[model samples]
Target: MRIAFYGSSLVSAYWNGAATYYRGLLRALADRGYAITFYEPDVYDRQKHRDIDPPDWCKVVVYEGTVEALKRVAAEAAKADIVVKASGVGFADDLLLQETMASAGPSTMKIFWDVDAPATLAELKAAPEHPLRRMLPSLDLVLTYGGGDPVVEDYRAIGARQCVPVYNAVDPQTHHPVPADPRFAADLAFLGNRLPDREARVEAFFVEPARRLWRRRFLLGGAGWHDKPLPPNVGYIGHVPTADHNAFNTTPSAVLNISRDSMAENGFSPATRVFEAAGAGACLITDAWEGIELFLTPGEEVLLARDGQDVVDLLAGLTPENASVIGERALRRVLAEHTYAHRASEVDRLFRNHARRVEAAE
Candidate 1:
């Protein structure tokens, strides 16, 4: 099978949050005998700060992100058996959706992968005349990274023929326990790109914990957060490289996962950090949200924090031995059930089922 995936970036995790998900899913598919062609815009500023390169399993194509460029890619993408236009491309997504759908041949399966389901669906509800209104129902499949029943229901209600949750998973081979880095060593660590919606959660979960436990050290790593005011206890390291994720997770006594506002409300939306931290065998503590236990058991495999005091209490009370046990259990669970290999196999089954349906219709 030939798969054409158009997303934010594959080689760099610069400001793009979906880079890890794209690389993990596509690389897994490639390893499973699918030939992949990834298309990204040159405007993402990621290629400049790229710390990683596309693997041999996939071919990358960069374009100027103009109407002419869209035309060129559409023609070439028509040859592929499966075409994916993921959300958060940060380019002309409306144009890309229209062009990709227009270019689709009868046999090709045009799928729209919504990495940011809450944001996308919210916009559609507020504005029904959005470009995706017409584009979505025409696509063969709609997949979301987060949001469980609500996301699926909304998509179907909005006229999507088929909608499914394709949640994020870890690539253990890429993210696993490594020796801690001295620079990142701390009592609690949080790594996430700072955005308006996420800043409040970060303050509540990450910074407030540091403030409450004044004696404990905290590490914050991400881009666009250097300007944000921080307390004396929290050490801010702007833009942690993708390659150092394991080291970052390992250095902290226990890592923290803070959801963006919408994601927390939507539930079942685990950020990439959840999987990455667990994969690195770090004792993980996250904010209270619905559907969390489905992915990681609270008492045995993970810790749930409702407020600053909860996180402070957990860090102060949790012994080294207890943290180690929790980390190990989390690693075991995600390695077994939450991995890109598992997601790739799920996609394969979905594709096979789609083929049967197409044949039946014919």
Candidate 2:
């Protein structure tokens, strides 16, 4: 099948967190013999910070951020067997959502893939006249980046025909153990762009822990936070590129994963970094969330923390030998159960099955 997917930049991870998720899922889908075209806007300085050239697996259309350009792309996108508008496209998203759905043929599958379901859901609830809320009933299906049954139930409550959670998974080929780089050496490290919803959590889970443990090294990477004050022990590296992620992940004795407010409250939503760190065989410490055990076992494959104190406690007792053992165990679990190939198979099955159902109805 031919698929046209509209999302934030696929070639840039600069300020876009979903870049790896898009690459992994789409590349795997292409491997399964699907013709995929990804449409991304040339906004957010992402175009200048291109991480990878357009891959052979998918055709990427970098369009101007204007109504005329969007209309043209929407027309082209409507010709595909499936047309998708992923949440957080970062520019003219409401118009693109409407245009993509309106332009698609009757037989074409219309999907709204939400990369951040919790935040999206909250927005929909706050404004009944939201564009997606109005369009939900018309969509063929809703696919989520992560949010187990709760997200499915909520989307269904709002009028989705079908809602499925395609949680984040690691692309073993893209992320794996490599020689640790000295520049990233730290007892614990975190990589995420600073945002309002996440900054407080980062302070609670990452900064506070660093403040408590002055002797241990803590490295922070991602956009923003250049001026944000940090404890003397915590080192800030602004915006590590995708190419250096493997080194960043492997070098840290343990890496941290902190979710935004909505995701933490809703639970079951694992940030893409969780899988990326695990893929690189890094011992990971994640803030407590529901459905974590479904992905990695607590205290065995991963370390779970409820607050800054929990993070500090986990780090204090962590030995290099034990961290290595935990990292190895997490690596084995993810390789066996949570690879992009595995996720792509699930997505492929859903696409085929949905097609069959639509045909039968006709």
Candidate 3:
């Protein structure tokens, strides 16, 4: 099987949170004998802050920002068994989306993979005149990275032939626990970019807790958070590399998971960080969400924080033995059921089912 992704940037995690998910999923697909190609335009200064070099598992093609480039790639897109257009390509002009969708041949399947399900749905609902609205019905399938049942139903209502949720999962080999370094070790740590919508949640969950636990060391890492005021006890380390993510997760006594506003409102959506933290055997302190229990059993495998005070209490109350128990349980659960390899198998099944349906129609 040949799979291709038209996304923001495959090799850079600069301002993109989907890089880890893409790398893990595509690499797993390659391991399963699928040929993969990721098409990314030279936009967003991604070249300036390239993180991981292109791996041998998949071909990474960089296209220039021109009509000629799109024309040149149209044939390649038509040749793929599956071609996916992710929500935010960073440079996908109206013309580009139309051109790419039109280029798909009868044999090639096209999918609109929504990485930001909540935000995309909100935008489309709020603005009926959105460019992608009309394109929804033409795509063969719609896949979302997060957002559970409600998201899938809504997409179908909006005219998607088939809609599915492929939630984020961990890559066990890359995310397992490692020896912690003193520099990164902290009572609590959070790694996420600062966005306007998530500011209040960040303050409520991370900043407030740090303020209450004045004596405990707290670490905050990610881009666009440099100017955000923080409690004196909280350490701000901007933008940790993906390679060092496991070390960062392992170093923390407990890692914090804060959902974005849209995701929190949608319910049941867990980001890549949740699985990554668990994969690293780090005690996870996450804000309460409706569907969290489906992924990790609260109190048994993961700890839930309702607010800043809840976080403060957990930090003060948890013993080393209890934390270790929770971390180990979470790690075991993730390894058994939530690895990228498992997700790849799920994708393969979905593709096979689609193929069978197509054959029946023929």
Tell how far residue 203 is off in model 2, in angstroms: 0.9
- Using TM-score as the measure, what is the rank order of every candidate, best first? 2, 1, 3
Per-residue C-alpha lDDT of model 2 across residues 1-362, encoded as one tens digit per residue: 99999999899998999999999999999999999999999998999999999999999999999999998898886689999999999989999999988889899999999999999999998898998999999998999989999999999998899999998999988999999999999999999999999999999999998998999999999999998999999999999999999999999999999999999999999999999999999999999999999999999999999999999999999999999999999999999999999999999999999899889999
Better of 2 and 3 by TM-score: 2
Compare the candidates by TM-score and give the number of the best one: 2
Candidate 2 at residue 250, lDDT?
Answer: 95
TM-score of each: 0.98, 0.99, 0.96
* Each model's total of backbone clashes: 0, 0, 0
Looking at model 3, residue 248 earns an lDDT score of: 93
Candidate 1 segments exceeding 4 Å error? none
For 226-323, candidate 3 gives per-residue lDDT tens digits of: 99889999999898888889999888789999999999999878999999999999999999988999899999999999888899889888888999
Pairs clashing within candidate 3: none
